[model samples]
Target: MPKVTMNINGRARSTEVENRTLLSTALREKLHLTGTHIGCDTSQCGACVVHVNGKAVKSCAVFAVELDGATIDTIEGQAAPDGSLNVIQQAFKDHHGLQCGFCTPGMVMSAAALLKDNPKPNEAEIRDYLEGNICRCTGYQGIVNAIMAASGQAVPAIAAE
Candidate 1:
């Protein structure tokens, strides 16, 4: 067993895990971060997304040992400093971005990372960037709208700014 340490959701954690243990497993099983869902064993689903060192990554594709000493942010850490919903999460709720909600956590995490880097992404850019995320329920239009709204854009009746 390889003992790995990671800073998750602003807390430092150390776990003795198997060498091949996936990051998603470490999060859900060890740290109990169930908000990061495991929708697929394959990495193509993007349902296990989380921020590793401030960038979004598919948790299913990453090994715990590889993330040793890295800083990770799960959906639980996305809340505002006051413990209120973050802009992206609020936008998702306001825009009806989720249905079954299985893919929502990953979607929000990915959008948060995207908005962190590019605060004002256009519609096409938003679509292009979200190609990796797969939403099984909402048909994706609402997700795009939510992200655009959260990024501070004047779209429809939504007050993005």
Candidate 2:
């Protein structure tokens, strides 16, 4: 077993995990950060997305040992210290970006990464950036609107329907 240590959500966390332990598993089972869901172990679902060293990556595809000493940000960290929803999270709620809530954490994480790289992404750009995220509910209209609203852009009445 490898003892992996990571800076998760601005805190140093250490866990003893097997050689084949996936980052998602280490996060959920070891670190007890269950917000990073394991919707697909094959990495196609994008439900395990998290920020590894400031980049959005599907946690299911990465090994926990390989990321030892790296900085990781999960959905648990994407909020104000006072527990207030971050702009992106608030936007998601206001826009109804989630359905069933299985994919909400990853969607929010991906959206945060996109907004970081392209703060004012247009509709087409937002859609393009979200290619990896799979939202089975809300038909992605609310998700798109949430991202736009988070960027301080005007969200069209797309969520009004």
TM-score of each: 0.93, 0.96
Best by lDDT: 2
Clashing residue pairs, backbone N/CA/C < 3 A, model 1: none
Instruction: Evaluate model 1: give its TM-score.
Output: 0.93
How many residue pairs clash in model 1?
Answer: 0
What Cα-based lDDT does every candidate model obtain?
Answer: 0.88, 0.92
Residue 3, candidate 2: alpha-carbon lDDT:
97
Per-residue lDDT tens digits of candidate 2, residues 1-161?
Answer: 88999999999999999989999999999988999999968998888999999999999999999998899999999998999999999999998888799999999999999989999999889888889989877458988998999999999874443
Deviation from native of the Cα of residue 96 in model 2, angstroms: 0.8
Worst 10 residues of 1 by lDDT: 152-161
What are the root-mean-square deviations of the candidates from the true structure over C-alphas? 3.1, 1.7
